[model samples]
Structure formats: structure tokens, C-alpha cells
Target: MKFKNLLLSWKYPSILLLGIGISNFGAWVYFIALNLIVLDLTNSALAVAGLYIVKPIAALFTNVWAGSVIDRINKRNLMVALDLFRAVFIALLPLTSSIWVIYSVVFVINMAGAMFGTTSRSYITKLIPIEQRKRFNSLRSLIDSGAFLVGPAIAGILFLIGTPILAIYINAVALFLSGIITLFMPNLEKDRSLEQSDSSLSWKIIKQDWAIVLNFSRQYSYIMFMHFLFSCMMVMATAIDSQEAAFAKAVLFLTDTDYGFLVSIAGAGIIVGALVNTMIVSKIQISFLIGLGSLFVSVGYIIYSFSSSFSIAALGFFIIAFSLAFANTGYQTFYQNNIPVEIMGRVGSVFGLLEACLIIITTTIVGVSAQFISIQFVVITGSIIMFALTILLFILSMKPSKSRYYSVKSVEAKDL
Candidate 1:
């Protein structure tokens, strides 16, 4: 796509994207700063993991309600309210030094964030046309990835200059600014007629009859399962890397800054991969691309397990980034094209809940496993699982019935 096409395509989504990106950046800043603070205060990996646990749990419960709320409410206003609510919770972080208080605030913030996420995704479907959804979704991912890339780098720099509290204060300011921008977005409301019936609350209307929502889950079951496994491998790698950091310093004589720089290289790779997806993969079939991407990622992680040099590890990180970008683009576009606009919120929320739950379990397992076995072993095992999933997906994709699940058939044909 040309630059003008990409820029013009975002005309309607620009403001919402900007607001969400700013808020996401703030969220990551707070996440990194909070983890650092907790590590300093408690000196316990388990304690830090405890704080992380709040996010998935909050998302799991809040998403069901949030989906229903999104279906019934004004998308723009719901987002604004959620942004303001999250800003308040983030603002409270710097005022407390207690771990319990911090955990509570994190849970609350995640709850509100889940609501915002569901609404935001649903709203985007209404804002953009179906044919252009892939490009738009890719652009959105690029923006979000950019925020993640910049947030931690900036936080680290600010921490070096002042303190963790100072970086946190900056994060709060970013959220406030995000909320302000959200207030200016155009009003985008849902169809009230579908939401107002008394029967809307009944189980059939809320859950059963919505084939759009149901199919989104059922059709992509294999892909989602693979993602869950991939998440586990990622967590295993992260845990290993964390433990290996000190080893690098003591054994290989590398500085902390060198390690940080290597991580930054991975972030750069993610950005590059996202850009490629938006530019090239938007017009292509998603399942084939995703399978190939998974293969790259699985192989990269497997190689990472055997790498003894920083350069080799960096190469592995780049492959992981490429795979993640490809998989995310394909999965997101598959949902956007296949699901009905009216129920996208509910469907997307359900997907989010499942994804969060898997990540939480996987991360926890990896964290706990580190106490017992070598991190290398854990990573290699995770890689094997991912590779196996990729092969399974590849085989499934070759089957007509299974392939149809990922195809974007018209509503009339889909009903048949």
C-alpha cells in the first residue's frame, strides 16, 4: 500500500488510535516501573509474579460483563469513560509504597482496560470497511507495538535520570493526556433496537443465537490453541533470559547496558515485522502466512536454547518478532472479516479472556518451573510444543472443512 492510502485509510480511526496508543504506552510504562519497584521492595520473583497474576484474573471476569456492556452502550463514550477511570487508578500508583495497594490498583486498572479493549475493537469494526480491515488492523498493531517499544526505553531513561517514582509520575501524566484526547472522538453508538428488548438478557439472545460470536471461537480453535502454546514458550524464554542476565555479567563479562541494547534489538525487529505485515500480507491468505510464521518462531526459540553468544540470541529474537507479527495480523484479520459487526465486541472479548487465561497459566508455569529445572530445558520444551502446533495447523489448513473455517464466506452462505 502507498503511504497516502495508509494515511487516508486512518482518517476515521486516527483520533481513537492516537488516544489508545498513548494510554497503552502509559500502561506499559507503569508495568515496567511497577515490576522494578516491586523487585526492589520485596526482592521476590514470586511477589512480582503475584502482581502480574491480577491482570488475567481481572480480564477473565470483567470481559464477559464488558462485552455485554459494549453491545448495549455507545462505543465512543464507553471508551472515554474507561480511559478516565483507568487514569484515576494509574494516578494512585505513585502515592503508595505497599505491595498490596499496588496489586489492588493494578487489578482495577486491568478491569477497566478490558472493558476499553473490547469496546475499542468493536468500534473499529464499525469505523472501517471489511475489505480494508487487514490493513487497518495491521496499522493498529504497529501503533501499539510502537508504544510498547518506546514506553520501556523511555521509562528506563527517565529512571536513570531521576527515579522510578518520577517515571511513574510521567506515566500518570500520559494516561491523563490519553483520556483528554478520548473525550474529543466522534460519537459512535451501537444499534439500540437490538439491545433494548427484554429478551436481550435471556441466555439465547446473550449467548446462544449469536452464531457470529460462536463461530469466531469455534472456527479458530486450533489457531487459538497454538497461540496459547506460543505464549507459554515466550514466557519460558523470558524467565530463562531473566535468570541468564546475571550469568552474562558474571560469566561472560557483559554489562547491563549491553543486555538492554540486545532487548531493544528485539523490539526493533517487532516494529519491522509489523510494517512488513501491513505492507505485504494485507492482500494475502492469512492461514498459510501464519503457519509459516509459527514455523519461524518455533525454530528461532529452539535455536535460542543452544545459543552461547549474544549475536546468536539476537538473531533468534528477530525471528520470534517476525513470527509474532505474522500470527497476530492473520488472526486479527480472520476475526474482523468473519464476524458480524454487531457481535464483534462479545466475540472479541471472549477471545481476549481465553488468551489472557492461557498467558497467565503459561507464565506462572514457567516462573515456577525455573525453581526446579534449567531454563534452557523449559524453553526447548516450549519450542517443541509450538513446532508441533504449527505442523498440526499446517495439516489442518490443507483440509477443506478446516480451511473453510478460516475463509470469509458471506453471511447467507455462512448460514447455510
Candidate 2:
């Protein structure tokens, strides 16, 4: 009876994680296949690089107004629609020969992806109970870590047996299956009114939503500051990561095979860390997870920045990748527990837009700086900056007075 009751409680969350896992695995397959396809067609590494640019560009275009629509819609149905939308577009990708056409399709797909991200976060927050959030998030992180390794291996197998185009179709199928699975989950807002309808989406309404997010930030200043600092840490990580290939080649003198092995080490670390995190998450405080996890991730980057050999770099990669699961799980729980479901969409989108902008700016700066200066110097500088930010995050997270922010009880959002 106890076992049955536990199974019943986890049924929906388990199903949701399954759908998320499928989608995440498919996304990785699509990413590798798309990069290969572009490289094969254009034979230009820069052309392949453009594929990375499309996602942030898409976010910039979509995120400004996506929240207004996400907050007012049926999140489950919208999630389903977005999955099908991406599936259709992904299915069509193999038929297109022009790189420009592929880019255009990918851009559209990414826009839908941005909206799906916010909608799913809000939906998950609504569906999961407060007390269960941390465990659920830890499980989700474990699934994501599994996907990180499995997705690439599956893509490689598909490439060996078939073409990259075949992998693309497989991803389309995966998205369709994910949509079907999502259909089985109950809708939390089935009877709730859409107070902020899509029909009211406009400059004025978007401005109001911005104001609402700003007002929330003011009321919950510490929370938003933590969010901002976390974003800064991620931005610096991105900037430093942009130089990874160059640093590996120029500084460490690593061959392609060596770099591949290094990545595999990181994958191993992720799986091991996630397994441990899952088993021990209930015993650890959410604040410590966010604080220590983030601080260690930066420490790992600092290690990598100063490494002279492949083994040292691999250790750095392992540490950062391992810490990622904890930091991600902690932040997800914190965001869901604190942000009211009513305004979560807007808050996520607004903050997402800021993060995207920072990514672009920071990446460009890092890239240009590497061209002019040593990649090692640029990477180390960025990592040091990240370390500083995480230290501040760690200090703030340990404050006894601020422990309320990480509590299991949800905080109410102020009215706009």
C-alpha cells in the first residue's frame, strides 16, 4: 500500500520528466546533426558557427513579448503545440538544400523553443507540490545529464548507420512522441481565467508586464539580485567557453581525439554527480546547493583556465560538469518555490531576455579579445570574474535572515 501510494504520487511528475527527457535527447541529436549538415554543405566552419548565433538572435526577437502570450494561455496545450510545431519544422529540414533556408527554419524553431521553455517552467511549478519540488528538480537534472551523454552516442550511431538527415527525422519523431506523452498530464489551469489574454498582447501590455516584473524585483530585491548575479556567472561561463576549442588547440596542443576524450570525462562527471545529488538532495539545504554548487563550478573554471595539460583540463571539466546538476536543481527549486505561478511567465521571459543579451555581448567580447590577445589570458580573466560573482552569491545564500527565500512555501507576487 505504501509503495502504491508513492507510485501514485510520482505518476504525473514521472511522466512529465519522461517527456522532458525525450525532448532533451532529441534536441541534442538535432544539434549535432544540424552542425554536421551545415558543415557538409557549406564546407565552412564559420557557416557552421552561424548556427549557434541563430538561437540567441531568436531569443532576442521572441522573448520581449513571449511572456504576455505564455501567461495567458493553456500551458499544456501550448507546450503540445510548440512540440508539434518544432517537429514539423525539423521534419522539413532534411528536404532543404540551401543553408539560408536551413537557418531561417532553425530561427523559427528556436523562437517556438523559447516560448516552450517559459511555458514549461510555469506549468511544472503549478503541477508539482511545494514539498516535492527539490526532489523533482533533482530527478529532472539527472535525466538531463543522462541525455547529455546518451543523445550524442545515439546521434553517432545514427550517423554511422544512416545520414545526418535520418537523425533529424528521428528527432522529429521524438518531439511528436513527447507531445503525446504530455497529453496524459493533467492541466492545472483548466478552470482558471486567462486574466492576461493573448488578445491584449501589445506594446502597452508588454510595457505593463515589464513594469510588473520590475515591481516584483523591487519588492523581492534580494531574490532578483541573486537571479542577476547567477545570470552574470552564466554569462562569464559562456564567454570563457567560447574560447575552449581555441585554448585546447593553441595552449594545450590537444588533438581532436584528446578533446573528445576530455568531453567524455565531463560527461562521466555529470552522471556520477547527478547520481549522488539525487540520493542526497533531501538532506542538503537548497541554499547550500545553490551557493556551494555555483562556487565550485567557478572554481572548476578557474582550474581549467590555469591548466597546462589535457589531464588538468579534464579535471576542470569534470568538476564544472559535476557541479552543474546541483546548481541547476537548486535554482529550479528556488525559482519555482518563490515565484508565483501567476507571473512566472513574465518574470522568466524578462530575465531570459537579459541573459540572452549578456550572452551575445560577452561572447563577442571574448571572441574578439581572443583574436587580439592570448586565449588563455581572456579565458582566465573571464573565469576570475565568474569566481568573484559566485563568491558574492555564496555569501548571500548563507545568510540566516534570507533563509525564507529558499523555504518550501511559495511567495505571493505583488499585483501589477
Q: Clashes in model 2: which pairs? A: none
List TM-score per model, in order: 0.82, 0.98
Give the per-residue lDDT digits (tens) of candidate 2, residues 1-416.
99999999999999999999999999999999999999999999999989888998899999899998888888888898899999999999999899999999999999999999999999999899998999999999999999999999999999999999999999999999999999999977685443435466789999998998999999889888998898898889878887888999999999999998998999999999899999999999999999999999999999999999998999999999999889888888888988889999999999999999999999999999999988999999999999999999999999999999888778875432
Best by lDDT: 2
Please list the C-alpha lDDT of all candidates, in the order they appear: 0.69, 0.92
What does candidate 1's lDDT look like per residue over 25-54, in tens digits? 877777888888889988998899787578
Summed backbone clashes in each candidate are 0, 0
205 in model 1: Cα distance from truth in Å? 8.2
